[model samples]
Target: MATVARTSMLGRLGDMTLPIGILAIMAMMVLPLPVVLLDTFFVSNIVLSLLVLMVALHSYRPLDFSSFPSILLIATVLRLALNVASTRIVLSEGHSGSAAAGKVIQAFGEFVIAGNFLVGLLVFAILVIINLVVITKGAGRVSEVSARFTLDAMPGKQMAIDADLNAGLLTPEDAKVRRADVAAEADFYGAMDGASKFVKGDAIAGILILVINVLGGILIGTIQHGLSAGDAAQTYILLSIGDGLVAQIPSLLLSIATAVIVTRVSSSHDMADLIGKQMSLRRAWVPVAGVMALLGMVPGMPNVLFLLAAAGAGAMAYFSREDGDEAVEGEVMPGAAPQAGGAAAAPAGGDESSEGIVPEDVTDNAPISLQIGYGLIQMAGGENGALVSRITGIRKDLSKAMGFVVPGVRIRDDLSLPPNSYRIRIGHRIVGEDQVYPDRKLALPGGASVRKLRGIEVRDPSFGMDAIWILPQQVTEAESDDYVVVEPESVIATHLSQVVTSNAADLIGPDDVQALLDNLSKVTPTLVTSVVPKLVPLHTLTAVLRHLLAGRIPISDLRRILEGLAELSGRNLPPIEMAEALRPSLTPLLLQQLGSITQPLPLITLDPELEQILIRARQAGDLDGGLVVDNGLASTVITSISEAADKAAGEGRTPVIVVASPLRRSFAAFLRPHMPDAIVIGINELPDTRRVEVVAVIGGQAGIPAPNGAR
Candidate 1:
């Protein structure tokens, strides 16, 4: 400390001679001037410096050839006017002598408060630079929205998919294609995300200026008063009103900066996207800025906060604007390969995706296209009411961890926003009804089904397409209401129609089926080939599948569940018969009980018109290779078998689930001779089903259960 002090002293001594020489020269120049005029210049010097600083700092921006000269000229003129004003004040106030004028001169010269203000501003500037640096250097996929500014910066799904593929979650070819797609998609949006922060900082910079100006003003007043060091510091803080703000220059500068930053950030990206509950709800930066602003006002802490607040505001504005869709539309994959289902086309598949890093398949199409997930979310109002179409864009950006948009899938309208009861349908067919209109029983599209609605008052003559809710109970199954024959592809939407028509299910989640699967897993390993394995309870499983559309249950675990079910019914059941033992009606109905948890269950991906098409194709033999397993056809066939086998033997009514796949046929044939107690059939052959009723079969013909080697 002593050595540093000695060095500073020596440096000061060297500079002291220059000040003395300048003073002597100044004295000579003023020797011939009258005392009043000369004193005026002295007093105004400090004032002029303050004025210049105020003007310079407030209107700062990138200098250009066109505007620089004019700015300088205006500044010069302003300084001159300030000097002239000071002279007039001194003369009119009748103040005299250098002693009294000295006070005014000292006010301009005092650096005590100004020094503190400047130091505070410098600290703020450094922090902003540091924050920007920290953000730019970081990488990875995370939600685009997060409460804390520093805690977000999530790795995007594209990045995540790449990592997963690289880690061997996918095939090489799939990885290559996905990598290209994610890269292009994430890069386009990522650029905008990154650039927005600077605008936020710029906005905050305005607040910084205002804070420093306040401190600077107080310091000048304190110095002019010529008080003791302790008193001068206290005066600026405890008694000052920031007289320099008389021009309100700092505040105006801040306002403009705020506006510009907001505009700039908003212009750069899709801002109205869901920032996740974390960022959009918590607003962490707002408090941080508020605190900093308060501190900045304190001279010691004011400047930093002011700038931080401005920057944060800028960022918020950028992230919150929902205006242009043009930018998002323009963001095409620059050199991306086509997407092939969920596989990557890389050498060793690894690509970031919504479901994490996974391998992808190479697409035969879209070699250079980016796949952006957007929703065609179903919109339904009251019975025949006007449906409000709402589309959520840029939701869950995940890049900044600021949002949680499901990757490659638009889940924006999955959950109800502005929560209220609304009707759901599968085209004209009403599938969901229990919760939709619990009190009203109106006719639906095909015939009549209006019992799902709730929290609504249905009138007797609220006519729309001639449906009536007069009963306030069940919608009588209409004669024309043919079974909704649909394929696996369109299962969810069709099932959703059931919810709309029957009021059979509600929103479901992951834990709904945890119990059923857990119990099922304890019985036998191969009993169930589940899509999602974690589900356990019957209702839970149903609900999970209902929402997620797919779920898994280990083969062993599924047997366990069957065994447990057998135990519940006090029957010694074998694994082969358990699935059949679960009444066909019961199994499908259980999905409704699970509410939304039913998953891993086959999704009906077939189109609404697909059944008709397939039927026609079957008649014309023109489908090339598509099958038609229309609605209730399987059930009606099962009923025929049940009635034939009137003497039932198992749980409720024993069902024979014929192995209709070719793979199972060959295997079942091998075991047929040894295991006579449990019947196994082949697709190519049929036995005397008159004695042993041919109950129900999936994936096959009436007589032939399955092909030789394609179980």
Candidate 2:
């Protein structure tokens, strides 16, 4: 009974916290506060303001501190209530001296202002000017503009979320989270715009309160207390200015905090680190050192101070250069490929390789790794590593699409690679290797431009489009010529994304599939328990999922996939056959990703005669695998399909090939090596709800035929 009572008592007290705080603030304004309590409250106010400022500086994004507006309002109201209470004390006790109001006010008057009322007043005025006219005003304006823009962009942001969801780049749960963040962001800025007025009003109220206290104190001291005019002026004026200073300093800090929050851009780093990294450029510091050294030599300058400043800047430059070098070189990890002839000589005994071996010596365990040459190292290291952030985003998006978390990419520098090259590996196999120029931009020429740009021509690594390696300064000129300019880091990141996405099947394993089942059990426990390892073994289920992924099918709807598997459990089919059987139910997912339901799906179809010939060839020769056709016929069919796919691509449409259901899987597999980009679907997989537009008919010389209407 005692323990229960104690728990109940704590919960009740927690519930009363807000109401109690409100009552205390109101009492501060209505009743007289003892000197000790007033001093404590004054100190508490300063501490609260500093705490707020620190939180604002450390917040990675505005939404990270979404309650700041409410907090700001409470702090402003508390400050105003303190002002009212202090004003009462100042007016009633001024004749007694500066210590009459509180020790905090007295300390500000004597210690801060050196017992000079004039200095205290001047300092308070400057603080008020800074808080009211500069920081508070600027923060309010920024809040207003940010709120307006955020609200204006809400529709577009929501549409983008929906588009990504439909495209399978975001799961429904991820879309919901993104939508909530967007709405919260809009509400935060809107609240911030209104809360800024409280800060402005607080600054104004401080100045007015100070003026009133000073005027009232002097009148009461001289007339009612019968003090001399100069004595009243000296004593009362000091007390009033000190009271204002104590309140105004905290108000200034809050104003600066408000400005920091309103003007802050969302970043992964804190304000201090972000600013430090951006300001640590060696080239920028070198110029500053040179200018400072030149000024130190001028005849009228303070040579000692100027030379010291020069030396400081020079030190910063040297350290910045050293930091850059360390960041680049230290990025190489333990798994990096060794340099030729640079391996340590064997010990007095035989080579260690002859005696024993470790796991790392035999194989890399990481699912995905990026190996960059020394010259391209800077793009993947240090505080502002663009490639790192981009790869993180890719993993997140791919995880949503693949229905499981994508493993993190490990980055390392390889000494054996050419200085300007990079290699992307999945497990132990290298998937992509390409060269890039860190100092240059890749400009892809669009067909709309007639003039050729002057630069070294190359093929785009991601898409194999004709591109030029142009100077960074020529970006604007290239854009004017209808060329798309891409950064080197973006080029590398895009290639990595493409490679990972294409080989997504290779990345998933039995363990990953088990993780998917574990997550599914939380929501649909019976389905997971009944289907996985009972109807289908874990490895077989993993193989089925890999086959779907190889066909560019998203497994995000794991519950639906499991339910489908349960219905087919009695057959005891192989993984490939099970996966093929599940495709009809999962076709909507693939179609929605290709295009929206509102637009007709662009399809490339083979001629009826050719389709029958391929199906017959597969049945006669290799019924279990791809169609086995004569070389001459295969060459002719591939050429015709390639031309049609290219034409549709030039017209900005994703071409989907429609084939008979019996030949769909084999034909798709056969075309995988030659036409990797082609998406082959069974005619039955085309839903009746979505319309289809026939873009081309391969292996025929006739005019275009009418598209099959809606399925």
Candidate 3:
């Protein structure tokens, strides 16, 4: 009980320390104090100033001393209060002598100035000038610039943190901490910017107080106390100068502390260690030694001092070089163990060396990978790097669109490719490759423009449109000319997004399918329990999902998909057949992606006669489930659809191919290779309330060949 009481009492005392100190400071400014108490407070003020300075010097970074601004404000106020108290004593008791104020003031006046008032006054003025003019002014400027730049760089830093989080390099909690640090750093610099004004004002007030104390004391002594002119001058000036020195010394310490903090850059080492390590470079010392030795031999120079300094520098350089060589020799390369014979031991197998060879177990490949050459690697991860963040956003958007979690993209560097080239892979297969200049912006010319840009002409990687790779400085000019401008990182990210979206089916497996089922089980347990594994099994469900994804239908509404699957459970239908039956339930999701249900969906339809011809080909090739269309007819059909797609895209509408319900799956497979961007939908998949505007009819043109004997 006694120990607990003692601990509780200490905690309460620690909590009250700030309020008690603040009240005391305020009390000192208003109330009168005896010489002994004033002397004690003055000494305490000097001690606190020194402590603050020492702390600032030892802090590894500015944020390590985040409370310095508040501390500076309180210290400045305390010094000013002390000044007011001392000024009152100095003016009221000047007729008595310098000792009338306090022993501290007396010692500063007599011992420091050697009883010479003019010398004391001159020294006090110089200290004020150094603090206010040089240190305070420079620190204030640094604070202003640091605050502005810190605020300006916040967005870039936040993007970098988010990129790291999405790239799996940092956890959400780690990113949160980093973001808080960035915000705190900005706040610290801003507070410092404002706190510096307190020092400046204190210096100005010190000068005013010194002048008032001296003049006020002289007039009171001579006129009021009937002292002689010389007597008043000696008495008042000595006391006034003494009080000024006492306040000025602490103020000088604080001013130096402020300068040190504002000029500091964040590092792992404190000021002393940082400076010592940087200045220990042997090459730097060697030049200094040679320069000093050359100067020592000059005519009329101080030969002995200069020559001795040069010898010391030469000795430091020689020892530093030896230490560096020893450090280099002591370093052991990874995987190279020293043997009893003082040589590296061979691998256990003895046939092959282990040096620089990566083991098979160490290579873990991601489902989706983006490998860029060295020149474009900078676009992958930095404050300004947008590729990683953009890819993360793409995955999130596609996940929502496709109704499944998109896997993370593993980004790395490949040195074998050309410096400007990048390759995107889906499960070890290269799906897209392109070149981008890091220092350039790509601008696509939409139509005839008033101005033409001079640059390397190239095709946009995502869409194969005509684009120009222009220097960054030309972006504004190109935009003014109505060209669509894109940064190099955006260009690469867009290409990767296209590749990933098209190959999303290849990325999903049984694991992803089971995860969806597990999530659905939480909401409708019986529905999931009856449909998955019990009726269709996990692999069949995965196949159904991949089939839906290949047709550009979202599986986000999994409950409805399961309801459709449950309806067909006993039928034992193929995965493609199951997907076909599920399409009607997923119509609303697809329609939502297109636009409002009330608005007409722009679509391209196949001619009835052409559709019949394709149906006959599919039926004829029924044994293998592959269409056996004539080669010439297939080429003609692809060419006609390609033209229609180009026309649809030109009119600012996506090329969605609408076919009969029976032919939707087979026709989509046939058109996928020739027109990857085309969206194919079955007639039965359209919601009843939805409207359609058929803009083009493929194979309806007069000159196209008939499919009867084109082979």
The candidate scoring highest on lDDT is: 2
- Runs with alpha carbons beyond 4 Å of true place in candidate 2: 1-4, 112-115, 168-174, 321-504, 507-525, 551-574, 580-671, 677-711
Task: Per model, state how many residue pairs clash.
Answer: 167, 0, 0
Alpha-carbon lDDT, every model: 0.32, 0.82, 0.81
Candidate 2's TM-score: 0.70
In candidate 3, the residue pairs with backbone N, CA or C atoms under 3 Å apart (3 or more residues apart, or in different chains) clash, namely none
lDDT of 2 by residue, 214-253 (tens): 7887788889999888888888778778788888888899
**What are the RMSD figures for all models against the true structure?**
22.7, 8.1, 10.1
Q: Model 3, 153-266: lDDT tens per residue?
A: 999989877765554345466789999999999999999999999999999999999899888888999899999989998988888888988999999999999999999988
Q: Who is ahead in lDDT, 2 or 3?
A: 2
Off by over 4 Å in 1: 1-247, 258-407, 410-711
By TM-score, highest first, what's the ranking? 2, 3, 1
Ranked by lDDT from best down, the candidates are: 2, 3, 1
lDDT of 2 at 519: 66
How far residue 652's Cα lies from its native spot in candidate 2, in Å, is 9.6
